[model samples]
Target chain A: MKFGILVNEGPYTHEASDTAYQFTKAALEKGHEIVRVFFYHDGVNNGTRLTTPPQDERNIVKRWGELADQHKLDMVVCVAAAQRRGIVDTDEAKRHGKDADNIAPGFHISGLGQLIDAGIKADRLVVFGD
Target chain B: MLHTVNKSPFERNTLESCLRHAKKGSAVLLIEDGVYGALKGTTVSGKVSEAMKSVTVYALQPDIEARGVQNRVLDGIKLVDYGGFVDLVTEHNATQSWL
Candidate 1:
């Protein structure tokens, strides 16, 4: 099965991101393909590499990046949401006159069309949100 | 359709609204704080118990155990893990997530 994952919350603040990550991992382990992982709303925060947490705690941002690298996952941070929340890639940063970019590895910025495309392509679109 | 609720019933009416709208034989899988709705002795327990008659109810096992309410889940509400979460999505033709 091909699955579309939609995440709508931040890393540490809500369990939504954790649950979504678990679900995505489980699906991949079961030999299902992830059509895409679409980050919208506060979920865009998951794509920022600037996050740092206590060493004792799980690093949610790095975890997603690792998962993407392992599975060759297509992880997209919504461009509109990322801009509003200050998550930027090199291109976006340069386009907006920002000096630096904070987007984490294994993620790219895109529009809502990618989300809609996932809905059309995947057999199931699972949403994890607050 | 498979309906997912992620907010505590005590904090929001999402579960109630989902139950009211879900068609007969639909599945309701509660996760995160929504696992609270699966408890046996809450104010909304009766409501959940009743909804089971029309729609099958499930609670994510990881979320339940994380909150340490595994023992108090209402009887007959199916418990599932993340793998089972994947199974539910494949079984259902569509899914709706209620915040």
Candidate 2:
């Protein structure tokens, strides 16, 4: 099955993002396809390039990056939400006249329409949040 | 239609209203604190429409784990990841958030 994911939870505070990774791995193992991973609200943090965790904790941002690299899946961060939350790509930082960009590589900043579109194309729309 | 459930079951506000309004073939997804609804026999959980057996009821697995209620989920509900959630929005005619 083709899957589209909606992640609304942040990495550090919630397990939603981590669970998303597990689901993606499970789907791939099951021979299912991941159409896209849409990050919204606090979930946008998953695309930030500035994440740094303690040695004792898991590096979730890197984990997501690895997943995208291995699967070649689309990782979409909501531009509006990302910017509002201080997560900016080069273009967004330049547009807003910010000092720096925090969006990581392998992640695209797109509109919510991509999420809606993914839903239309995917056989299953899974949501991980809280 | 798409219904979003907020964390609280007792609030009887937007989330409750959405649940009450959900029609057949609709979907109800629990996010954030709303995952608590996965409990088997709560009064709020009991209100879910068993009649609409095809209606998809899902809980964010991450939220379920965060709240330490992963094992408490009932059998009928589907544990969805982010991608599956997006598919729901696409499959449905409209999506509504209750919180």
Best candidate according to lDDT: 1
Task: Compute the lDDT of residue B70 as modeled in candidate 2.
Answer: 83
Q: Which regions of candidate 2 deviate over 4 angstroms?
A: B1-99
Q: Backbone clashes in each candidate structure, one number apiece?
A: 0, 16
Whole-model lDDT per candidate? 0.95, 0.78
Each prediction's fraction of true contacts recovered? 1.00, 0.00
- Give the chain B TM-score for each candidate: 0.98, 0.84
**Pairs of residues at least 3 apart in sequence or in different chains that clash in candidate 1:** none
Off by over 4 Å in 1: none
Best by TM-score: 1
Error of 2 at B90 (Å): 14
Model 1 chain B: weakest 10-residue lDDT segment is B62-71
DockQ of each: 0.94, 0.13
Question: For model 1, how does the per-residue alpha-carbon lDDT over A1-130 read when each residue is reduced to its tens digit?
Answer: 9999999999999999999999999999999999999999999999989899999999999999999999999999999999999999999999999999999999999999999999999999988888
